[model samples]
Target: HTPGYGSAAKYIGSITKEVIRDGLVYDQQNVTLLEIMGRNAGWLTGAAALAKCEDCEGPDMIFLPEIPFDVENFMKKVEELHKRKKSVVVAISEGVKMADGRYVCELTGTIDYVDAFGHRQLTGTARYLAEKISREVGCKTRAIEFNSLQRCASHIVSRVDITEAFQVGGAAVKAAFEGETGKMIILKRVSDDPYICVTDIYDVHKVANVEKKVPREWINEAGDYVTEEFVSYIKPLIQAELTPIMVDGLPRHLYYTDVEQKQSR
Candidate 1:
């Protein structure tokens, strides 16, 4: 889990192209963006960079917590990009720390610890950055936190991701029935769109908090975004695939299983 913003900026650049083609590029080269996610691990943020890399007018400068933040250095980088492109997008992780070893997000709220995984709960880091940039850079800035929406967002689950999640759960059940205890099934995506996945068994303890991070090789350093290699790697996960079911403008939840045992009265 090497820390850096290069990966995130690249992924976000990829997905942004779709929106740009749809006329979502209001700022294009002028708009600046801040992405908030990842304090210890930037997996999600890396994915965003990959998304941005796919866009024609992707982000210009990205900031991640991996590198201890220096306000002067950041301002200098942003100013450089702005001068080069007129409009710029800067992605910053909410957990970015300062020279004094404090997170910029602290101004919004007190950093609280949640015992769930020793990860600091966060808020308003993007807004804080946006305000600072607006005042200093004198450019309109937008801050977007992917939020829980990106997780339960069944819509965005790469066809690959959803299928793999399902297969892993199903495999875990099957393995349990086979007396394979203390193990979990995992889905490994081999490709995108058409959707190819490989399911394997892994020890639950072996994967807990063993974060897989974005590879720097997938980032285009010169372009300040991700490359097609990363896009191809993740494209399958976001396939528009869904489970077949009847819809009535509401949830189609069913309460019972198809098979049942006979009643013994």
Candidate 2:
């Protein structure tokens, strides 16, 4: 989960908070579900937990692929949250599956194909969960798939992450100049409170293709939410903001597919 993950997560945390603010103003009961992008890793989905703070209530519940999802228990949890608050927000990973390894997307019959990765294509996870919650609770439910918007939202990016991304690339180039082969650049967090961090090189064999999961200790006992430890870890990464390079009030992209299409014609 490198390159664009931190930037996308910053967007996730920001959008989630804004959605919560807008949802609470309504007098009627409703359920809002955000489907985050994460297949095997729940790292992106876990960012939803960062939306919580002194000012924002954040997500009422969060479901990650790391934990087995129980529909009966999920519905009951929603009912309980709805009883306490009119606006109940839930953040779920697109890959959240049951104990038997079946995805919730199967319930809606939305999975019709697989990608080159041989994994089932995920698109309707949020809608499936949304409709299910609507039917069970008889409330107004909305499903928001942060999709490409999460990656493209330049306005919601984190400066710290962008700087680190640049630093990592530079380090990689430096390593190559020194004739270092089979190595990867990794961010080794030196401190958390003051948010001190630095990049370090590691052997690709030791670090590459290895899955570092969100430790169970970082997750709460209920397994539905993350602990403060997780929050503290991500808090620094989201700090600082960057202004996108704009042209005529629009953020300019390095390339536009439409322009290339027109030129081909």
Worst 10 residues of 1 by lDDT: 1-10
Per-residue alpha-carbon lDDT of model 1 for 1-265, expressed as tens digits?
1111223333344444443343344644344455556674444554554544332554455555655667767777777776776556566666777778888778767677676777677767777777777788787666667555444434233444444566667877889889997776766555555556677788989987876645666656642445667656654444454553548765465455545433331
lDDT by residue for model 2 (1-265), tens: 3666677888899899999999989999999999988776788889998789889989998888888889889989999988988899999988888889988777787687977657788778889878887888899999999988888887878888889899899999999999999889988888877777787888889975566778888878887988888777787788788887889988876765998989989
In model 2, which runs have C-alpha deviations exceeding 4 angstroms?
205-209, 254-265
lDDT (Cα) of model 2: 0.85
Cα deviation of 2, candidate 2, in Å? 2.6
* TM-score for each of the candidates: 0.70, 0.89
lDDT of each: 0.58, 0.85
Collision count for each candidate, in order: 36, 0
